[model samples]
Target: MEHINQVIEQLNLEASLTLEEIPQIDLYMDQVIQLFENKFTESKRNEDDKVLTKTMINNYAKGKLIFPIQNKKYSKEHLILMSLIYQLKGALSINDIKATLTGMNQKIIKEEIDLDSFYTSYLNLTRQNVEDFKVDLEDSVKDVNEEITGDKKGDSPYLKQVLMISSLVHMSNLYRRVAEKLVDEITVEKEEKRHK
Candidate 1:
């Protein structure tokens, strides 16, 4: 249970992380259900929506939880986004989130994604990398900053996400590189034989 929330916050399905490319969203939604199973799908009785509202939301919206004119209740999606807002805090901007969502929507429309598989394993793996990357990411960011002045400030959310999967992708490609080198060598040797 403790590790569940840890997976959500630590998991990095960076913006470039297309659903088509990855297995799942770190199984976040499933973790949420498991975390509060008694409160949600498994509960014998229903609970009021009011309990979902919290003072923290006001702070997240910069101290303004405007009661919507279209009935004053919050849905799970809103709560989830708000929770992200809180987690991301100063690291990401509202505009960034909007753009990300818009991009995600476009991907869904463009590429009929089948979002059925559980990504808990990927999520847990990502979470582990994020922890491991703390110092490495900071150092790399610093070096990158030194290279470019006024570089849109701290922790490029873009890079943060890239560092994780790119590392894995590159690692996977290492074998490809070796295979390619072997093939090149074989071709060269065969060509030499033909020439002789």
Candidate 2:
């Protein structure tokens, strides 16, 4: 329990770089990896965890999940796209991620919003929700713990932990499904507007 509390505290302290904080100058692949490693050092759970990798970046480009690099250098837009890919890869397939990003990429290409502005808006929106999300997560964990404790069926502690994890996984999957649907709908709506 103490360890769990400590982890939560650490998570609350962790912060991603804001749009303005990201480097404005273009970076080569190795530089991009180094930058991410430095920026995300505090957030890494273990030495084995990857921050970013050359192969991953190349794979993303090959998969069309991100825009093509220019002169083998990544711009701020590429950094933003890489960040999104890193976060989304946990719960979404590469194809799904590509579908979700395609609309935004089109908007960027059309000068609807620059990369910095797009990332800034995303940061603002997520920052607004961060506290609320923390509260909700704490509440959910407490509720699960209380419910498990109240049960008198003599379930083992390990089983209780498994049950808690399963419940959380289910909730995460549901959220991901909803998010995918929402992204698809938004993309369709944008396409309709473009064609009209």
Candidate 3:
């Protein structure tokens, strides 16, 4: 188990494994299964999401998930993006998250996501717009009704406060899938052009 962990230590997400190392995945997976069996603890899945989120933020900020190995090295950039998928917390499988995050990292590599301008713009808008939306929604609701309704009230602007975050999460997932195909197309085109 220690050997398996050592081999993975500091290896980037896209790190190449030798032919000799290829067959060891089965052995490592067996260890994983044994570890899971020995330490079975039941908790809400969302708790894992919280743990993932905290781990990702810390790792990304610090630029690595696990500590450096003696010689082996993993990609810090790769794991920073992995943090986002960690919050997803296995609602999606490890393979699924890896595929999705890989595409996102490619997008970042290609300048599809402009880090400084994008987050700065988003944060500024989110800060002001969130309060505006909430205040306006409350005032509108108070003007219209003095009491609570039994219905879902899904139509209200107030619903945006509760649902928009989840809706964005869903939309982000949808867009990531769509974007992955585009990445495939771009990769193919680049390969074809290179051969010519």
Q: On a 0 to 100 scale, what is the lDDT of residue 1 in model 1?
A: 19
TM-score of each: 0.27, 0.84, 0.29
Total clashes for model 1: 0
Model 2, residue 12: distance off in Å is 6.2
In model 1, which residue pairs have backbone atoms overlapping below 3 Å?
none
Each model's lDDT:
0.40, 0.77, 0.41
> Is candidate 1 or 2 superior in lDDT?
2
Question: Can you write out model 3's per-residue Cα lDDT over 61-140, one digit (the tens) per residue?
Answer: 35432223222322333333433444333354444444445545556667687544543454456457545644654554
Per-residue lDDT tens digits for candidate 1, residues 1-196, read: 1133444444432221222433333333334333333232322224442222234444334423212212334433333344334333334344444433333234434644432222334445556765665545455545544534345553455554455446546754774566456545655665787799
Candidate 3's C-alpha runs over 4 A off are: 1-103, 111-113, 140-144, 147-196
Q: After superposition, how far is residue 93 of candidate 2 from its true place, in Å?
A: 0.9
Candidate 2 residue lDDT tens string, 63-162: 8887778999998888888887877887888878888888777776686877777677777776777777667767766776777778877445775667
Steric clash pairs (candidate 2): none
Candidate 2 versus the native: TM-score?
Answer: 0.84
